[model samples]
Structure formats: structure tokens, C-alpha cells
Target: MFNLFVDSLIILLVVVDPVAVAPLFAALTHGESAATKRRIAIRGTSIAAGILVVFALAGGTLLDALGIGMPAFQIAGGALLFLLAVDMVFARHSGLRSTTEREQREAETKKDISVFPLAIPLIAGPGALTSVLLMVGEQGDDPFVIGTVLAVILLVLLVTLVSLLASARIMAFMGETGANVVSRVLGVVLAALAVQFVLNGWQEGFMLIEENASQMLTV
Candidate 1:
């Protein structure tokens, strides 16, 4: 359980990449009043939290309804996460996880962006949503593990909110190079975790096939 909590926390934090998104947040909220910026940060984070929580709680059921098995979800989720990790390690913007240049330009022109780029794509993006589903599904209906994963999700969201609130200060302190260095380190860890997910999924899939074959032979 402790391991699950730690692993979930690490995966959530890395995928969320609060520090990397700080610059974007800062840019988006540039020249806004302190009160307005506060509203944006709070609103964005709250909406993002709601979205992630929904997916974490109901995502597995939704997938099951679609006849998607855990092994397949794990394999695909692992691959997607690995791609995002590669983007993080290279300090590049991945359309899978990050907003594109077009989005950024459009955001700059918008008066309100709490829900568009900030809450959806930037915070609760594909990688983050897929991660929550994978982690929750990996728990396999264990209440303790599920609770721990959910807690980690909330914790990461809290941290992300704080990072957004302190974007300017954090950017000033870490700078671009320092931020990239931290992201790369987390990216490496994420890549390893992604590979483990894929391996577990593959092994389980093969075992399932073998078991089916044996059952057929016995019958």
C-alpha cells in the first residue's frame, strides 16, 4: 500500500509537470491583477481536480463497458506515457500532453482561459487522465490501494495549484534550465514505470491466453 502510494504520487507528479507548466501559466496570466490571477488559478485547479477525480473513479467502469480489458488498457496507457516521458526528457511540447503553439496563441487572445488551455489540456491532459485510470485499474478493486491512489491524485492537484499560484516566483528561482533539468530526471523515472506497466500487461495477457488454451484442452 505504501509502495502504491509512493508510486502513484511519483507518476502523478511527473505527468502533471507543474513546474514545466508554470511558465505557461505565468505567460497566460501576465499583467493580470493579483485578485484576478488568484481566481484563474483557483478556478483552473478546481475544474481540473473535478475532471481527474471523475476519470479516476469511473474510468475503469467506462472502459469495461466498452469491453476494454485491463491488460490492453495497461499496454496502451504505458505506451502513451512513455511518449509523454520522451517529450519531457527532451523538453519538447508534446501535442498529446501539452498545448500546441496554435493553442497558446489562441489562449493569449482569450479574455478567460481558466477552463480551456489551463484546466483541460495543461492540467488534466491525456497523460494525466490515462495515468489515473491505469493506477486505479491496477488497484483491482482494493479499497486501500484505490484510496491511496486517489489521495495521491488530490495531493498532486494541490501541489499543482500551489505551483500555479507561485508561478512567477518559482520561475524566477528555478529558471528555464533548472526546470528542464528537474523535468528530465522525472521523465527518466516515468519511462521506467511505463516500461513496467507494459511488461506487466504483456505477461498477464499471455497468461490469460495460456489459461484459456488449457481450459479448452481439458474440456
Candidate 2:
């Protein structure tokens, strides 16, 4: 349980990446007043938290409805996360974890960006959603494990909210280069985790195949 908590925390933290998002938040709310920035930060983080929680709770059901198995989802999720990790390592923006250039342009024109780029793509992006689903699915029907995962998710989101609220200060302190350096380090960690997820998926898949083969032989 302790290991699960730690692992989930690390994976979610890397995927959510509050530190990296701070700079982007700062940029997006550049000319906004303090009150407006505070409001945006709270609303954006709340929406993001809600989205992620819903995914964590219902993702496995959704996958089952699609007739998708855990091993396949795990492998695919890991691959997606690996791509996100590469983007993080290079400090580049991609649709997996960040807004596209066009999306940013659109965001600039919008007076309220809490829902568009901030909540949907920035805070609750593909990578983060995938990570949540993967973690929750891996826990199976263990209530304790699932609870731990949920707790970790909330904790990470809380950190993200605080980061967004303090975006200006964090940006001033870390700057782009400093933030990128932190991201690169975390990216390497995420890459290793992603590979482990893929390997675990392959192992589980092989075991399922072997079991099916044994059943067939018996029949």
C-alpha cells in the first residue's frame, strides 16, 4: 500500500506537472488582475480535478464497455506516456500534455480560459487522464488501493492549484530554464516508469495467453 501510494504519487505528479504548468499559467494570465487570476486558478483546477476523478472512477468501466482489456490499455497508455515524457524532456509542447500553437492563439483571444486550455488540455490532458486510468485499473477491486490512488490524485491536484495560484512567483523564481531543467529530470523518471508499465502489461498479457493455452489443452 505504501509502495502503491508512492508510485502513484510520483506518476501523477510527473504527468500533472504543476511546476512546469506554472510558467504557462503565468503567461496565459499575464495581464489579468490578481483577483481574476485567483478566480481562474481555482476554477480551472477544480474543473480539472473533477474531470480526473471521474476518469479514475469510470475509466475501467469505459474500457470494458469498449471490449478493451487491461493489458492492451496498459501498453497503449504507457506508449502515450512515453511520448509525453519525450516532449517533457525536450521541454516542448505537444497535444498529449499541452496546448497546440493554434489552441494557444485561441486561448489568447478568450477572456475566460478556465475551461478551454487550462482545465481540459493543460491540467487534465491526455497524459494525465491516461495515467489516472492506468493507476486505477491496476488496482483492480481493492478498495484500499483505489482509495490510495484517489488520495494521491487529490493531493497532486491540490499542488497544481497552489502552483497555479502562485504562478507568477514560481515563474519569477524558477524562470523558463529552471523549470525546463526540472521537467527534464522528471521526464527521465517518467520514461522509466512508462517502460515499466509496458513491461508489466506484456508480462500480464503473456500470462493470460498461457492460461488460455492451458485451458485449451485441458479441454
Candidate 3:
């Protein structure tokens, strides 16, 4: 359980990628007052947390309603994350985890970006959303484990909020070169985790089929 919590924390951190996000946050909030930037950071992280919590709580139920299995979601989510990992390793922005070209252009023209690209796509993008749901579903119906998962979610979001709050200083200190180096390292980690997810999904899927077959034979 402790190991699970730690793994969950690491995976969430990699997917959230606060270091990668700082420069973008700094750029978007450029020219704003310190107070306003702080507000945006607060609101963006808050909204992102809310969105993730909803998905974590209801994602499995929603998938079941749609006749989707955990294995299928795991494979699809892992594939999407792997694509994001490639972009991260190369220091590129894939729309899977970041903004699209159109979103970026639109963001530039918006005054309040807290709820737009910042909260929706930047902070709580597909990578982050998929990660939370996967973690929650993997834990099944254990209340303690679910609570731990929620705690880790909050922990990651708190880190992200702090990163956003310190974006200016973080970007100035790290610069693009330094940031890319960190991103590439995390990218390798993310890629490995993504592959693990896919494999877990495959194994679980096979086991599920085997169990069904045995049950049918008994009946």
C-alpha cells in the first residue's frame, strides 16, 4: 500500500509536470500584476483539482455505463500518455498534454486564461485526467486506498500550484535549456510507466477472459 501510494505520487507528478508547465504559466501571465498572477495560479489549480476529483470518483462508473472495461481504458490511456511522453522528451507540446496550436493562439488573445487553456488543457489535460482515473480504478473499492489516491492527487496539485506561483522565478532560474533537460528526464520515466500500464492492462485483460471462461464452463 505504501509502495502503491508512492507510485501513484510519482506517476501523477510526471503527468502533471509542474516544471514543464512553469515556463508556459510565466509566459501566459506575463505583464500581469503579481497579485493577479497569484490569483490565476490559485484559480487554475483549484479548478483543475475539482476536475480531477470528479473524474477520479466517477470515471469507472462512467466507463462501466458505456460498457468499457478497465483494460481497454488502460491501453488507450497508456498510448495517449506514451505519445505525450515522446513530446516531453523532445521538449515539444503535444495537444495530449498541452495546448494545441489553435488553443495557444486563442490563449494569447484572452485576458482571463485561468479557466481556458490554463485550467482545462494545460493543468488538467488528458494526461493528468487519464492518470487519476487509472490510479483510482486500479485501487478498486478499497476506501483507504481511494483516500490515499485522493491525498496524492492533492499533493501533486499543491506542488503544481506552488510551481505556478513561482513561475517567474522558476523560469528565470531554469531557463529553456535547463527546463528541457528536466523534461527529457521525466519523459523517460513517463514512457516506462506508460509501457507498464499497457502491459498491466494486457495481463489483466487476459486474466479476466480466463475467469469468464472458467465460470461459463462451471455453469
Candidate 4:
């Protein structure tokens, strides 16, 4: 259903939080010219798209091969989400660690902050990765749903690109306080989402165990 796509897209956006990454983008490209920043945004997002798409396409298969169930995944995802949310609430980096020493060097040397911090950890961090896994697990092999999710990702990428292009204006508008507020609010939402993920995992585990027991009784 179209609704399925919508649902998945919403979850992905919350998980990705490209808007949150905009500030980081600004920080990374602070001294660069407008032209360079634009290029970085494009390159960074394009690279991120490749990475996520690979995950989106292969996550389901990888889990199935490993015999991991959705419930287990949900719990793991929830835990990660919870941790990230807590980080966000505290004005922490949400464990992104982009503003670090080693990464800073890489950012400076590569002259492509977009691909390094902006795209990799910021846009497609651990929380995003876990969310993708859960989403892929939920969607199963539904082609339409998969397509919808991809479309949404592409759309988000576009938004990120545009935001980067307009980075200066964006910074002036949201400023530091406004951006931090959004981060904290999203963090709250993420924490709740994490709790739900853990619950879902537990429920699935119980159901699977019950099914196994019933089969034993029949035998």
C-alpha cells in the first residue's frame, strides 16, 4: 500500500535526520567557498545514497542468511535509537563523533567534508543503519515498498543537497539555539521509538518460542 511507503519514509527521515546534519555540514565547510560547499554536499549525499541503498538492498538478505529474526533486530535497533536519543537530548553528538581530531584531519585533507562526516556518520550513522535493518526486515521482499523507501531516500538526499546549497541562509535562520532545540525534541522522539523497538523484539521472540513449543506438542 502507498501508506506502507509513507510509514517507512517517515521512520527513515526521523532516523536519518538530514536536517540535523545541515549544521554539521556548515561546520565542516565553514571556510570553504560557496562553490566548494555545493560540491561537497553533492558528493557527500551521493556517496551516502550509495551506502544506504546497498544496505537497504542487502540488509534483508544478510539477516535472513544469518537467521536473525525481526524481533531480535527490533530490540537491537530500539536500544541504539534510545542511546542516540539520550545523546541528542543532552546536546551531545548522538555518538556521531564527527567533530573529532582524526576525522577533522580527514575532513581537511580530503576537502570533502560531505563524504566524510556529513555523509558517513552524520547522515548514515549507527542509528540510521539499525533503522534501515529493521525497515528492510519489516518490508520483507515487497518490491513496491522497497521502491517507495528508495524514493523517499532520494527525496531526502535532494533536501540535503538544497540545504547545503543554502547553508548560509539556513544557519542565519535557525542559529545555534533553534537547531539544538530541534535536536533535543527529535531525541525525545527517538528514545520513545527505541522503547517501542525493544518491545517489538521481545514480542517477536516470545511468539517464535510459542510457535516452536506448539509444534513440539503436536509432534
lDDT of 3 at 40: 88
Candidate 2 Cα RMSD after full superposition onto the native fold (Å): 0.9
TM per model?
0.96, 0.97, 0.96, 0.91
Highest-scoring model, lDDT: 2
Cα displacement (angstroms), candidate 2, residue 209, comes to 0.2
What C-alpha lDDT does candidate 4 achieve relative to the native structure? 0.77
Off by over 4 Å in 1: 138-140
lDDT (Cα, tens digit) per residue for candidate 4, span 1-219: 677566567666767776677777777787898788878888888988888888889988888899888888888778878878888788776564245778666776766566668777877777767776776666658887677767877876787678778777878999989878987887787788779779978988999899999999999
The candidate with the higher lDDT, 1 or 2, is: 2
Cα error of candidate 4 at position 166, Å: 1.6
Clashes of 1: 0
What is the TM-score of candidate 4?
Answer: 0.91
Strongest candidate by TM-score: 2
List where candidate 4 sits over 4 angstroms from the true fold: 96-99
Indicate the worst ten consecutive residues by lDDT in candidate 4: 92-101
Q: Rate the local accuracy (lDDT) of all candidates.
A: 0.89, 0.90, 0.89, 0.77
Q: Candidate 3: give the clashing pairs.
A: none
The clash count of every prediction, one per candidate, is 0, 0, 0, 0
Residue-level lDDT of model 3, residues 105-169, one tens digit each, is: 88978878898888888889889999988898656578887888889989999999999999989
**What is candidate 2's lDDT per residue for 1-219, written digit by digit as tens?**
898899999999999899988888888888999999999989998899889888988888899899998999989999999999998899888678777788899998888999988998888999999998888875657889778878998899899999999888898898889999999999999999999999989999999999999999999
Q: List the residue pairs that clash in candidate 2.
A: none
